[model samples]
Target: MRVLVVMGSKSDFHIAEKVTGILDEFGIDYDVEVASAHRNPKRVEELAKKDYEVFIAIAGLSATLPGVIASYTTKPVIGVPVSAKLRGLDALFSIAQMPPGVPVAAVGIDNGKNAALLAIEILALKDESLKKKLEEYRERMRS
Candidate 1:
């Protein structure tokens, strides 16, 4: 499955790279890009039409990347709110308070690890090996 990791700013690279690492460790193929909901809105609209099973949008501040993706595609979009000023309250509120209809699966502020895990969960639906690996991963975490 091809997963897309999109960030609103290049500044999110440091945090978002961890998600890249997790995907790499799982042997999952992914494409990473920086696309702004404000600046590169057209690019965002285009990627929405491409073939990707899921999207993980990592952004702070206004944090509308996930909602934008959700609006553009039927594929699942997971929002990872990178911590911004105001102790990430701004980020959390921006992501958590979505109006009716548009929904995004929001993860913790700067928690790219969970973002990767969530992506794996979604992909594991059709992959038995991936499902077993995820089960083992969770077991190791608990034990």
Candidate 2:
């Protein structure tokens, strides 16, 4: 798969749907998996080791899933913070505050659509057809 969408729990599937919808519109290949950083670190590690070019990690509370994925892989990681509690500010901060070296791009809380768009943008860098599609998508948005 070109992209792997990992959620911390099944409860985050609603947010994951937002991400997958955009990916589907863009014709990007992706797989969705539920693995929590706290509850199942090994599963996260295994998922990270997969051959996907990009990862979109959806998590709330501590929001460590993205950072943990980043630690395991060199591929680009996009963090989508869910508003499970605290209006999602706490999740937002947790995602945004990754330490140096292991960098993860953070999107706005509950903004899975942007995360998918960003992932498509990254893939477009090496793909001419995807680049053209993105250009067309942006034009559609502008109109």
Candidate 3:
């Protein structure tokens, strides 16, 4: 399966790399795009329509990326809060406090690593082989 990583700004690339690395480790394919929740909403909408197992939204200021993805897609959205002037507190609040109906699993600030893990978890739901791979990955982590 493939995942999509959408960053609100090009500056968030460093953080998105962490998630992409994890996907590589698991042998999962993914595509990355630079789009703003505000500046490039149309691209975001289009990406949501593409074939993707998960969407990792990374943004520093307001954490709007994940919510926007969740609003448009039935696929799972995992949010990576990037470091900001507020030290990502604003982003954390914005992502975590999503309305009850729309859910975006939020990760720690700048930790696309966790965002990737969350994506794997969601993918495992319908993929037995990937689920086993994930279990092995977790076992290896403890080893």
Choose the strongest candidate by lDDT: 2
Range of the 10 consecutive residues with the lowest summed lDDT in candidate 1: 84-93
Clash counts for the predictions, in order: 0, 0, 0
The local lDDT score (0 to 100) that residue 100 gets in candidate 3 is 87
Identify the leading candidate in terms of TM-score: 2
Could you tell me the lDDT of residue 119 within candidate 1? 95
Q: Write the per-residue lDDT of candidate 3 for residues 14-121, one digit (tens) a residue.
A: 998899899998888899999998998899889888889889999888878899889998888998888886999999889999998999998888889999998989
List model 1 lDDT by residue over 21-137, tens digit each.
Answer: 989988899999999999999999998778999899999988988889899898988899988887777887888888888888988889999999999999999999999999988
- Please give, for residues 1-143, the per-residue lDDT of candidate 2 as tens digits: 99999999999999999999999999999999999999999999999999999999999999999999999999999999999899999999999999999999999999999999999999999999999999999999999
TM-score of each: 0.96, 0.99, 0.94
Model 1 scores a C-alpha lDDT of: 0.90
Name the runs in model 2 displaced over 4 angstroms: none
